[model samples]
Target: MLSRNVYPQTRPGKWSVLLLLAVFSLLIVFALIVQSGQPFNLDTLFDNGWAAVVSILAIAAAFGAFIVGLYTIFRNHERSAAVFFTVSIGGLVALFVLMQLFL
Candidate 1:
């Protein structure tokens, strides 16, 4: 009888998952703030230094999450579906955001 070896599935690195969650939470908060209709717009965001800073930071965080996710998948042999989903979607979202902000 021949038996196949089964290796344990590796989990994603802690930072990658945490950063991804943080980015999503920030997106939800921004959506809520905008939906509240309190005169918030890109112009207002730029005019208010703090808002602009926060938005930029969020974008940075998104990119950070994408990089970390890729690192884990390639270097650490991550097997989680969630990590794959996060990396693919997060990377695209980050690029879209950069284009919207600067172009």
Candidate 2:
């Protein structure tokens, strides 16, 4: 017979993980569109409306993941690598937005 571990390992919050994945997938799509062998710049984004839309979605997902990650860590008490990754990714997205607005 197999024995179960006495102490159960905590997993990341589900919603947070989902949001983090959404952020990454959107970013990947946006990158693919932007890096399709032409000069990449903000103007290139404007040229491809799909890329701009994807960027917005990625930003939104990143913010959502960050908030959900914090909630999971504090309220749900989830202790997992994925939650930390969610927070870091979200923080980067927030920082980028802030820099664009101010700088």
Candidate 3:
């Protein structure tokens, strides 16, 4: 039997699992973009491979931020959680822009 508090609590390894899932998703999107052969360029970065790399990094960073947010939330660190969430969203948007420009 699980207590209500336990049910509401975040699992210790959940962040890592979520990060891995996000990585996999990003990889799939990268592969798809590579297959499409579309022209993408923004601010000097032009190669398809490099674009993919930047996108993957951005996604990973965003995922890391989200993980931090989760940790903050679980620990009742409201301010830090808000900051992490904002950064995570910003990273995601940056990734999208990079994809449009370079991939």
- Candidate 1 lDDT over 4-73, as tens digits, reads 2232244445676677788877777666655665654456577655556666767777788788889888
Model 2 residue runs over 4 Å out of place are: 1-12, 35-44
| Sliding window of 10 residues with minimal summed lDDT for model 2 | 3-12
Could you give me the TM-score of model 1 versus the true structure?
Answer: 0.68
Per-candidate TM vs. native? 0.68, 0.73, 0.36
How far is 81's C-alpha from truth in model 1 (Å)? Answer: 0.9
Question: Each candidate: how many clashes?
Answer: 0, 0, 1
Q: lDDT per model, in order?
A: 0.70, 0.77, 0.54
Per-residue lDDT over 5-100 for candidate 3, one digit per residue giving the tens place of the 0 to 100 score? 311224433453345456556767767776676765534434566555857675665557555555645575343333444446646755786788
Name model 1 segments beyond 4 Å from true: 1-12, 32-44, 97-103
Please tell me which predicted candidate would have the highest TM-score against the true structure.
2
Sorting all predicted structures by lDDT, with the top scorer first, yields 2, 1, 3
Give Cα distance to truth, residue 55, candidate 3, Å: 0.5
Task: Tell me the tens digit of each residue's lDDT in model 2 across 19-78.
Answer: 888887888998888787765555555677888899889889889888888887787776
Q: List the residue pairs that clash in candidate 3.
A: 41-101
